[model samples]
Target: MQAKEELQTHARSSPAVFGYPRGRDRRGLRFVISVSLQLDSQGCLRRLQSTGHAVGPQGGNTVCAAATALMRSASRALADHSSIVISGHAPREGVLEIEVLQCGAEYHAYLRGVTDVLLRGLKDLALDEPSEVTIRQS
Candidate 1:
């Protein structure tokens, strides 16, 4: 299939799903990173979302805090880019969902980098505490 067709196919498929167990608590860090990227289309990033629930025991709270901070950081990265529409919400307990719609051509690299960093952070966290954290990708 052509590149555009392949991108459309990926967009239709289930997003890259990920979840990590929270430390000392079963409620570990969980999130979904999904993006519908297209170059020739009207926009560069058709959809971008990072959403998850982070809440457990005291240790879990720390993990959740880190997760939410990352989310906010990513949000700030795109704050001034007017071509993109961004929305994010987090409860005091640490449930966060950040969505960026219609990402433009200029910030494509920035968004990709942010996504990579987030994934790496989660993977490293899970590795450090195997028993307390679990990571799944599909």
Candidate 2:
């Protein structure tokens, strides 16, 4: 079997930290929590935004610094960038939950952000960075 397939199998069999059980619900598993100092496409100082991340001209240097910092911290934490999972939802006020999968295969880091961040109404958590990285699904 392919390496990706193998990993997927492992994840499914193993209980996920967040979201419904893999066997019970696969379709809802698409959601994720991605955090980077990177600016949203519309671009400004957005601390937390969901998939479809947009970095505009105003994205500025701070964004780079923030994202770089996040990357550095995360890389150090896991020692592997690809396996990192940036979570967006917080179960409480100014608090977040991060669940790094077994063997450090997946790293999820959660942080508190604005309503836009929670407006997406998360149902699951993905370790991978979202393509768009929007707080909510359009």
Candidate 3:
């Protein structure tokens, strides 16, 4: 089956997992940010999209900074893999969309780890803001 078809099937069968959660923390702070990731068969990351603004009295700069760093790091890591096709866009404020197509086998582990780390960091950031991040099999 094709990648798109596989994703559709996976989506239908599996429930979406939380990359981050939408609810209140122990401190009773409610969060509203969310990030969702979809991985294709063979364990390759296919897409990552995030929405919601950074919260805090500090401003949105920190969230933007984190997002920028994550994107840069991911981009650089994938740079050596000519087989992978990556596309990203940050249109409007507090929105990020990144997609990776045709990830080669040799770089699969590295790319997956990179995304995992990025999500972990985003989770940490979500503690203060309303952040939710999730990874799902495609």
Candidate 4:
């Protein structure tokens, strides 16, 4: 009974903390994929972190696959640029983290372009799959 009350309190305070919105009963939500983006002072993406899994039926989750692909593609693209110093790794399954340590001024445009595409793709995905994906940009 105490645990149930605690869960109810938590749900009321921050429903999305468990991938369900306030006033909505938790139903039909298999999982949630959270993506976080950190921007630099110049408004360029400096860090990216994605964690969680959107589990679909029959063990096939297209949302998770798509999101992971997009993040990996962006990280690979950034790593290819000589003027950009980036570090990225997948510490475990369904988790990815990338950080841009340094970037030359001349390559700012390129960096912006790549990050813009990544952000746009992620935002679009979130829009299409709101229940399965959540994004937080800082």
Order of the predicted models by lDDT, top scorer first: 4, 3, 1, 2
- Candidate 2 lDDT (Cα, whole model)? 0.32
Expressed as tens digits, the lDDT of each residue in 23-101 for candidate 1 is: 2123433432222222223222223334443333333334445555655676677666786667766554334455666
Task: Assess candidate 4 and give its TM-score to the true structure.
Answer: 0.74
Off by over 4 Å in 1: 1-61, 130-138
Whole-model lDDT for model 1 versus the true structure? Answer: 0.47
Instruction: Evaluate model 2: give its TM-score.
Output: 0.21
Clashing residue pairs in candidate 3 are 19-133, 19-134, 20-132, 20-133, 31-130, 32-130, 33-130
Between 3 and 4, whose lDDT is larger?
A: 4
Summarize candidate 3's per-residue lDDT along 1-138 as a digit string, tens digits.
Answer: 698786545332211231234543233333334667676664555787766543332242455467557755776677567866688887755567888866776767878787777767766665654333332334
Please list the Cα RMSD from the true structure of every candidate, rounded to 1 decimal place.
Answer: 15.3, 16.5, 15.6, 9.9
Model 4: per-residue lDDT, tens digit, 1-138? 999787546533433554555423255333677899999776788999887767443235577778888899989998998999999898776678999998898999889988899999999999998877899999
| Lowest lDDT block of 10, candidate 4 | 21-30
Residue pairs with colliding backbones in model 4 are none
- Candidate with the larger TM-score of 3 and 4: 4
